[model samples]
Target: MYRYDDYDQRLVDERVAQFRDQTRRYLAGELSEDEFRPLRLQNGLYVQRHAPMLRIAVPYGLFSSAQLRTLADIARRYDRGYGHFTTRQNIQFNWPELAKVPEILAQLATVQMHAIQTSGNCIRNITSDAFAGVAADELIDPRPWCEILRQWSSFHPEFAHLPRKFKFAVNGAKEDRAVIQAHDIGLDVVKNDAGEIGFRVLVGGGLGRTPIIGEEIAAFVPWQHIVTYCESILRVYNLHGRRDNKYKARIKILVKALGIEEFRRQVEAEWAFHKNGPSTLTEAEVARVAAHFVDPAYESLPATDAGYASLLDENKPFAAWVKRNVRAHKVPGYASVTISLKKTGVPPGDITESQMELVADLADAYSYGEVRATHQQNLVLADVRQSDLFKVWQSLRDAGLATPNIGLLTDIISCPGGDYCALANAKSIPIANAIQERFDNLDYLYDIGEIELNISGCMNACGHHHVGHIGVLGVDKNGEEWYQVTIGGDQGNKAAIGKVIGPSFAAAEMPDVVTHLIETYIANRHEDERFVDTVRRIGIEPFKAHVYGNRQTEKKVAHA
Candidate 1:
């Protein structure tokens, strides 16, 4: 993790002090609720349904064991006993008192963390692959560059108040785990044919009311000009992106209106003037940042652990956990374990303070004291030894963090919907819970296999509904909660937005509808094909028919 220097420390400290004063004024009644909105938002505070929610940034989803412990402390002392990890890999406390947020920010500053840019129409947290440093197939770790952007964009005067929130993601791995194609600006770090480092830049990709896969604006941006090139793109957006309508303000809409060719031309024209200027990165600076991310020391070991094999043979639950939660690592005898937060009937991505403490302790005892937060809202012990897998599994199971469903149908990605988010039209968590309750059979979920179901409260797509094999979008219809279903979306090399099946369903009918969709897939899919591949091969007609066929008749028949 990148440590904060003196300048970084001072900047955060100053911001904390500023927010502290602002909080005091608000509490004193000098600042009205309307007046105080943007002030609090800029600091990552939101007035939720019941109470204020404070989002704390976990930059690039990297945190030390100590940092994890600090977060646990905050959750225990400040708000509720648990915190919700967001889809962006940040964490949010739902029940914080509005007046105490500045104090929370002060505490976060001590750990080199803050909530700045976590909200607002500025460059949000520069996310990267959660498994960046340790992924076996990575070309390079993307965190250092993410860190560089984080520093540069923090309180950037030129683009601070943009037309809408800007998001950026960098992926250096062969697999697009970072979901780069779904970001406002996506950078793929690649080595050229001549073995020189550069980037494949994609711009204007986003998922909201209008979902789009980013277009490639620059095929091979040189390493030195990353900052300048990025600035050029932002500058272009800032100048032209709509401000009259919030829905039309995002760069994705601008790109759509202009077309990819024109958007690329404008960015190039801007970059031609700014390229190799003051923002151009020097080799020394890159090395200095990269030094912080060097690989960890590893002990030589065999490819497979006999002890692990024995443990798996002895314990069925542990064996199931290993099959789903454990991932292959570059180092032999080492594995990356995902501690699932999607336990049945619990809010997805939420961890209690006690669970946080347990995970921190386990990380220290089993995984060299390092922990990672996955983009899918799960906690990871990245360097766990295969030999200690059983012991770790036992500990996690006891802590309620072991939910042997990593890629299964029940491991849903959901946003804090109507229960918490002001923007949400309906409660998604309840819908998710209803679905989970309806389909609590592990064997059934396993049979369904490797399905991703994402739910968003609204069209903002914070839950990444567009990328799920089964996507649910919560909509408001005549003061009633309704859901629109989309099928066959994916977030990989062959990324595609899901197509809506047909008419929306009432909240109560969602689980049955989802079940019908899955049944349709099972009935139509070819042998060994995943849901996405099957959907691609057969198209959405079968699923649509299953979902919407004779809707009026079916409703009447059910009533009868």
Candidate 2:
């Protein structure tokens, strides 16, 4: 992780002091609730349904063990004992007192973390692949670029108050694990035919009321022009993006209104003015940033560890966990271990303070003192040794973090729905809980195989329901809670939106509806085809027929 420079440190320290004063003023009655709302929001403090929520940025989802311990301390001392990890890889505390947020920011500053741009209409956290450095297949590590953008966008004078929030993601790998196509600005690090590194830039991708896959604006932008080209894109959106209505204020709306070609043309025109400007990255500057991300000292070991093999032979549960939670690392003898937060009966992505501390400890002991927050809302120790897998798993299990449901049905991705979010129409957590309860069989989940079950409480798609293999969107019908089910959505390299099967089901019927969909896939799928591939091959009509059935069959079943 990049250490804060002198300028960065000074800026954050001053902002904390400023927010402290603002908080004191608000508490002293100098500022009304309405008057102080935007100020608090810009500082990443939200007045939620129950209490104030403080979102702390985990830049590019990277954190040191010490930083993780600090977060755990904050969760324990300042708010509830648990914190929710968001899709953007940020952590949110739901019960932080409004008056204490500035103090929290002060503490975060000590660890080189802050809540800036976690909220508001400005450019938010710049996210990237969780397995960036250790992944076997990567064009380049993306954290350096992410950090550059983080510095450029933080408190940017001209773009600070955009019409709506903007999100950017960078992917250096072939797999779209970062969901780059679903961001406002997505950059893919690529190598040209001559083996020179550049970027494939995509613009206008977003999800809300209007979901879109970003269009390629620049196919091979040189590495030097990254910041310049990004500024150009933002300037185009800032000038023309809708501001009259919040719903249509995103850059996606602007891109839609102008067509991809015209949007690209406009961005190019803007780039013509700034491509070689001061924001352009120099080789020396790039080298300086890249220096912060030097590879860890790794020992050369065997491809397979005998200790891990022996443990796997003795413990079936441990074997299952290793199969699911462990990922192949680019280096031999090292593994990327995902600590599943989606345990049965526990809320997905919610980790207690103790658990966080334990993870921090294990990261220090076994993974070079580094941690990563995955977009799947899970925590990762990205450089664990194969020999230490059992000890790590035991520690995680003691902390209630050992759930072997990485890609299982019960491993749901859900937004903080009506219970917390002001935008939700219905509670999604309860629905997720109900489904988890109904499907508690680990063997069954594994048999069903890799499936993405995502739920969004509203149309904003925060949970990415549109891209789940089994997507559930909560709806309000006649003042009652309902869930609409969709199947065949995917968010990987071949990203596609799901198609709705039929009518919406009551909240109580959601579990059964999901069960029916899975059963339909199981029965109809040929050989080893996954749910998504089957749906794409046969289309949704067959699944629809099974879900709704024929008119006569439905009547007969109802009568029975």
Candidate 3:
């Protein structure tokens, strides 16, 4: 993890004091709600359905054990005894008293954390693959690049208030775990055929009401110009993006209206001014950032540990956990372990204060005092030794964090929705809970195989429903909640937006509708085919036919 220097600490400390005084003024009647709106939003405070919610940014999802312990303490003392980790790799604490939020921010500052630019119309968090450095298939480490961007974008004067919020995701692995194609600016750190490092830039990718898969703006940009190129794209968006309607304000809408070629041309024109200017990075700058993310002290051991093998052969539960929640590490005897926050009773990505402390303790005990919040709404110990795998599994199982459902149907990604977010049209937590309850059987989940089912309270797509293999979106009809289904959406290199199956269904029908989609997939898929692959092969028609039987289809048509 990157430790804050004097300047970083001074900036954050000053911001906390500024917000504290602003909050006091608001409470003292010196500022009205309208006057304080931007003030609070810039500090990551939102007026939600029942109370204020505070979102804390975790840069590239990386945090130290000490930082985790501080977060746990803040949740325990200031708000409820829990917090929700989000798809953007941040955490939100619902039910924080408005007046107490400044105190929370001050506490976060002590651990080199803050909420600046987490909300309002500005560049949001910079995210990347959780297993950046250690993944077996990784080509480059994205942490340094993500950190450089994080520093560049925070409180940037020119982009302080763009048309809407912006996002960036960097991927350096063969597998796109960061889901770069779903971000406003997706950077794939790559090496050209001539063996020089650069970025494959994809601009205007986003998911909301109008989902879009980003088009390539530049096939390759040299490493020195990454920041300058990003600034160029944002400059174009700020100059031309719509401001009349909030729904049409994202960069994706502007890119679509102009077409990819025209969009690229505009970006190129803007980039020419700063291509090799002062913003261009030097070798020393990259190396300085990269030093913070170097490998931990790993032991030299055999690739396959005998104790790990014995446990896998003897214990069924342990073997199942290892199969689902563990991943290959680049080192010979090391592996990354994902602690499934998708346990049966727990909401996806929701961790209690006690559970947060447990993760901290385990990070210190097994990993190298580091943990990552994953895009799947899970927590990962990215450098656990293969020999210590059984002990890690036992501790997690006892804590109820080990559900052995990593890529299975039960590991859902969802948002707070109507439960907390005022912007949500319907509730998302209940639908996610219903689906988890419906698919509680581990054997059944394994049979279903690796599938992503995402639920969003509204089309803002906080849950990233547009990229799920099975997406459930909430809609409002006559002031009542209804759920819509989309299939064949996927992330990774072959990213695509999901298409709606048919008319929306009542909330009560969602669980069974999902069941029907799975059944249709089982009936049609060839041997060893995944759910998304099956949907792409057979199309959405079969799933729709199976979900909406003939008479129901007619009723749905009439309703539509």
Candidate 4:
């Protein structure tokens, strides 16, 4: 985990003091709503349907147990005793009083955390793999690179206000846990044929309104020049990206308007300005940043623990939970455990204050006092000892954090839709709950196998619905809530945007539609094929035939 130094601490402290006065001025009517809007957004405060929603940045989804405790305390004192983890790997408090946000931010600063750049048109939180450094298949630790970008982008005046909000995701593992292709800028840390460390850059990748898979802008940019390459891409987008229509303002639209070749040419031309300039990273700079994310003090132990093996044989429940929740760690005798927040009937990603405290306690006791928030809205203890697996599972089960469904259909990623966000067209939590209930049977879900179901209130793609194996987007149809369904969307290196089946459906028809889609997949799938795999293999037509034909079959749906 990265610790904030004096400079970092001072930066956050000053922001808190500055925002306090800004909030005071707004409340005193010295600043109008228009004047206060950007100021509040820059501080991660949004006036929602019910109250102000405060988003706290958890850089690269990494935070300390002490920070977690502070978050829990803030939720208990100022919020409704719960916080929502988002797909960007940040947490949101939906009911914070606008007047009290500065106080909350001040408390966050004490623990080296802040809400800066969590919202607004600036670069949002930098996301990475939950298993970044510790994953068995990792090529290099991405946390350092993520941290480097975090430092470079925060409060950078040049990119303070782009055509629209920007996002960056970094991945270094064989598996693309960071979903790089769905971001404005995606960096894959790779080694070239000559065995030199470099970055494979993907620009103009995003989801919302128009969902497009990213193109490979640069095959292998040397690691030292990644920052400059990213700056080049952003510079191109900042200059030419549409600003008049908010809907067409994204970099993705610009990339589509100008072909990928032209976009790459423009970026390459821009890169020449600072290709190996002072901004280029040096070995010392890399080491200085990486020192913060080195491997934890580990012990020599056997590959498998005796008690853990016995428990796997003795308890079927524990074994099932382990199969879904536990991932292999690079270090022997250690494991990464994902505490699923997608429990059935619970709002996906909502963690209560007590639950947050429980996770912090578990991290201290088992994972070296560090916890990683996942882009899927889950919490991870990345360094749990194999021998202590059962105890960790027991503690989590008691806390209602162990749902034993991590990548299953019931493990949904959703946003706080009509209930909290004023930008939402429909309620997302209810749709997620309905789908979770529809596939509540554990054995059935296990059989269905690795699938992503994402729901969003609107097209901002907060839930990343466009990349889910099964995606549900809420639409507003004549003041009523309707649902739009897309299938075959997959993330990772071979990322692909899902295809819309036909027209949208009423909210009541969503569960049935999902059920039929599942049935269709089961009927057509080959051995060991996942839902997304089956969708890709057989295409969306068969699933569409079953869902629309039987449910309304003739492609019946409502408004766009």
Candidate 5:
């Protein structure tokens, strides 16, 4: 709910005008594709297979009802009446005409939103936990820090064009919902023994070709110096990160080339110069930013609502939905509800124009007029009152957004692969749909427990396949599409990249392969064990054998 002031409004307006002029020049043949590539990419415009894709940044995944309506309008007028929510909490319009992008950006500016830094080799949107301020286990509201970074990084000339793109995530809760360890820079808000607030910084973590978990660069950076510490890390990376080869350009490669100790030393040396400089945040500034993220007007109510309890007792469907889509809130009378966008037949994260308006209306009526997008490509009503849970669920169910499969196997994270992205070797949406159809049974999915199945068209890892419990990567085998599988990846504080499990299979063979993997997990699991936990404990060999040993069985399962 941060409102833009005159300065913020001016900046966005000027950016829109600037891009409009650039677009005009490009259209008039004054700039070649090579010349305009970086310019357009910096504004979040990518030329996909069929058309130009525009990624709109939703900072920290927060949106007001008005902004949601604006997005819906843009989708209906400028796009194909739908938008794809991404793992970074951004939204993508897959079929926007390159000529009309500036017009679309002008519309976005009216709502205080823009696509700046959503793409290209600059710091992208600063993300945080979807339940940042309201979660039961939150240590602090990370939205303030996320906003602070967004301000600091937006159009910052020093880091505008680095070796490669950069990402930053903040985890303010005990649960690592932000998946900080998978970002270029990760921050965990912490309180020291003396009760002073600070941050634990993790640097050089990414998930592309050479996936590596970040290392702790600073154990404790005081709140006032958080910006200074981040600046130091970015400065070190800007100067030392590889630039010759695009594949090795990320900061992770630089950190690997220089050991963590050396990287830490370099960052420390850089930090000493600006630790107490003008960039160091003051208490007043911190308070000013934090004020925007304060708790909503909560009513005085008992810890348990009678009506909510009665619904849980009486309605099995509602109970199941609460079990999966609802999360505990810090406030006793409130809950956070995840509106799943991954319906069985629909492409994961794709939301139609009508659905966006519906969510906006629901947010206004039930969630304090605000919505938060999760890194899992879903939307969150972060402050829903427990008393209104059934009503909110009913509205969401009517919109086909109440899938009740949060954290389940069918809640897949995927990218627009060969279907839209020219860089993709195989189609990701079809694979996700196939898997979702195969695992459509909610009861069976709940029994199977929490499983992250991510698919990417290529190794760009846009779908974060490397971090999923069940990771699928599409590869180009000769001229055909082959899918490779990986397991045991996790994206929490203890992040780990998955390992390849032998030869790749044809596209039609993926569902059966995934089923066998699930069957193997069920066979090997202990009481109430998660798929990832089981994989970590038992290793990938058992699942691999089950998938590869019985081709006839896999064929039968695939046909079924």
Candidate 6:
């Protein structure tokens, strides 16, 4: 984790004071709701259904154990005993008192954390792969670059008020775990055939009502010009993006209207003016940022330890957890563990205050004193030793954080829909809970294999339902809450938006509908074929037919 310096601390401390005054005015009725909307939004405070919600940014999803402890304390003291981690790798406190939010921000500032640029029409949090530094398949560590961008994007005067909220993601690994294609500006840190570091820039990628996989804007932009190039793209968007309609104001809409080639031309034209400007990063600056993220003190040991092997052989539950929740680390005798927040009976990504404190303690005891938040609404101890795997598993299991399903169907990504959010069309948490209960059998989940099931309350796609293998979106049909299902969506290197499967169903039929899709996958799949691969092989027709029945009945319903 990058520690804040004097300048960073000063800026955040000043912002907290500013927001505190704004909050006081709003409460005193000196500022009307219309006047305070942007003021509160800039501070990551939202007026939700019942109370004010405060979103705190975990830049690139990285935080120290001490910072985690502070978050836990905030949850315990300020809001309810729990907070929800979001798909953007941020956390939300749903029941924070409006007057108490400034105090919350001040507390966060003490730990080198704040809510600036987390909301409003500005550059949002810069995210990346959670396993950036430790992943075995990683080519470059994205944390340093993400940090550099985090500094650059936060409170940038040029882009302070853009047409819409902007987002970007950087992926330094061959595997696209960060879901780069789903961001407004996706940067793939790469090396060319000539062995020079550069970026493969993808633009116009976003998933809201209008879902899109970004088009390649540039084949490669040299490492020195990454920031400048990003500036160029944002400049073009700020100048030409629509302000007439909020729904049509995103960069993706601009890219679609102008076409990729034209969009690229405009960006390139803007880049020419600032190609070698002050924003261009030097080798020394890059190295300076990179120095903060060097490898941890990993002990030299055999790839597989005897104690680890023995525990795997002796404990079946631990073995299952190891298979799904644990991942290979760059170090020989270490592993990255995903502490499952998707346990049964709990909402996805909702961690209790006690659970947060326990995780912080576990991170210090087993891994380093750092924990990571993943885009799938899970937490990761990115440097757990292989020898201590069993002990960590037991501790997590005791704390109800050890659900053996990581990439399985039960590990759902969902939004706090009508339960807390006023923007939601239906209740997302209940739907997610229903699905988790419906697929609680570990044996059945393992048999089904890796499935990305995402649920969104509305088309804002906070849950990224458009990219799920089985995407579920809540729709309002008449006065009833209906659920719409989509299939064949993926968020890997070959990202694609999900296709809708016929008409929407009542919320009561959601779990069965999902089951029908999974059963269809199992029946149609070849040996060892994953659910997503099977969906790609056989289109959504089979699943749709199974869920909705024949076209003749569909025609009757349309007539009726």
For each candidate, what TM-score against the reference? Answer: 0.98, 0.97, 0.98, 0.98, 0.98, 0.98
After TM-score superposition, what is the CA distance of residue 387 in candidate 4 from its true location, in Å?
0.6
> Relative to the true structure, how large is the alpha-carbon lDDT of every model?
0.90, 0.89, 0.92, 0.92, 0.92, 0.92
Residue 28's lDDT in candidate 2: 99
- Model 6 has an lDDT value of 0.92
> What tens digits encode model 4's per-residue C-alpha lDDT throughout 10-63?
998999999999999999999999999999999999989999999999999999
lDDT of 2 by residue, 67-140 (tens): 98999999999987989998999999999988788889999999888998888999999899999989988768
Question: Per-residue lDDT of 464-514 in model 3, one digit per residue for the tens?
Answer: 999999999999999999999899999999999999999998887887888
| Tens-place lDDT digits, model 6, residues 1-560 | 79898999999999999999998998899999999999999999898999999999999999999999999999999999998999989999999888899999999999999998889999999999999899999998889989999999998999989999999899999899999999999999999999999999999999999999999999899999999999999999999999999999999999999999999999999999999999999989888888889887889989999999998999899899999999999999899999989998799999999999999999899878999999999999999889999889989999999999999999999999889999999889899999999999999999999999999999999999999999999989886798888988999798999999988877777887888788788789999998889888988788888877643465587799
After superposing candidate 4 on the true structure, give the runs of residues whose Cα lies further than 4 Å from its correct spot.
Answer: 552-560
- CA lDDT, candidate 5, residue 109: 95
Off by over 4 Å in 1: 550-557
Q: Alpha carbon lDDT of residue 374, candidate 4?
A: 95
Which ten-residue region of model 3 has the weakest summed lDDT? 549-558
Local lDDT at 354 for model 1: 90
Question: Better model by lDDT, 2 or 3?
Answer: 3
Instruction: Name every residue pair that clashes in candidate 4.
Output: 548-553, 549-553
TM-score of 1: 0.98
Query: Residue 94 lDDT in model 6?
Result: 93
TM-score of 5: 0.98
Residue 373 CA displacement from its true place in model 3, Å: 0.4
Worst 10 contiguous positions by lDDT, candidate 6: 546-555
Error of 4 at 432 (Å): 0.9
